[model samples]
Target: MSRRVSDVMTRGSRALPLDATLYDAARIMRDEGIGDVLVTLDGRLCGLVTDRDIVVRGVAERRDARHTPLGEVCSADLVTIGPDDDLDTAARLMREQAVRRLPVVDDEQRPLGIVSLGDLARAGGVDPGVLSGISQAPPNL
Candidate 1:
């Protein structure tokens, strides 16, 4: 039987409200040793903000992290999956979306966990070449 996303996903994924500042997101990422945080609005998943997002969209643009809300810089075009989905599905979604992480959500769009490329690697079923491609450093701007 194929493993489910919940089997390897990182549970208790950190989340912050849309109004939360970039600094708040950074602190959570720092303290939790995570690269991204789910952005929520009224308890529903709304977007995602990564460390790179903060640096590129917030800091590079000279936006004050202390005051700039995540809503302003977060990637709202999210591609999420569900806990019961097969790991293969997650891997495919990650590949097709060109995203490193996928927020596992419930029917109500509440984030339950996050499945990362590393998680798929650890699960040991995804194509190695795909993982390698995803792991490659992003090209310079």
Candidate 2:
């Protein structure tokens, strides 16, 4: 009996349109106490934007947060999971993708929730070393 992703995911994750500005995404992250947000186009998941993305891609690049759209800085190369998937699958995907967060989407690619390293940690099944590796600062950073 494996645990489903929905069992440990953070439901009702925040999302914003691709046309939305970085400031909009940052404001939502601040209000929700979340580090990332799903980026959508015409209500379909298209990309993901994170606090690090805002800092490195948006700020560090000198893009005006208020004028720059999320589509411009969001990570379009996404690896999503399904709510019905097992925790092991989530862990494997995160490891293979070297990503700390995964958007849980449906067959239609509409985001349902978000699964993060912290969420997996609280679930108590994934290996701690794997978690540690994911949380480690990148060599270039």
| List of clashing residue pairs for candidate 2 | none
Q: How accurate is candidate 1 locally (lDDT)?
A: 0.90
Stretches of model 1 off by over 4 angstroms after superposition: 137-141
Which tens-of-lDDT digit does each residue in 48-136 have in candidate 2? 99999999999999999999999999999899999999988998888777888899999999999899989999999888888888777
Candidate lDDT values, in order = 0.90, 0.90
Best-fitting candidate, measured by TM-score? 1
| TM-scores, each model vs. reference | 0.94, 0.93
Off by over 4 Å in 2: 137-141
Q: Give candidate 1's error at residue 93 in angstroms.
A: 0.8
Q: Which RMSD values do the candidates have, in order?
A: 1.9, 1.8
lDDT of model 1 at position 3:
95
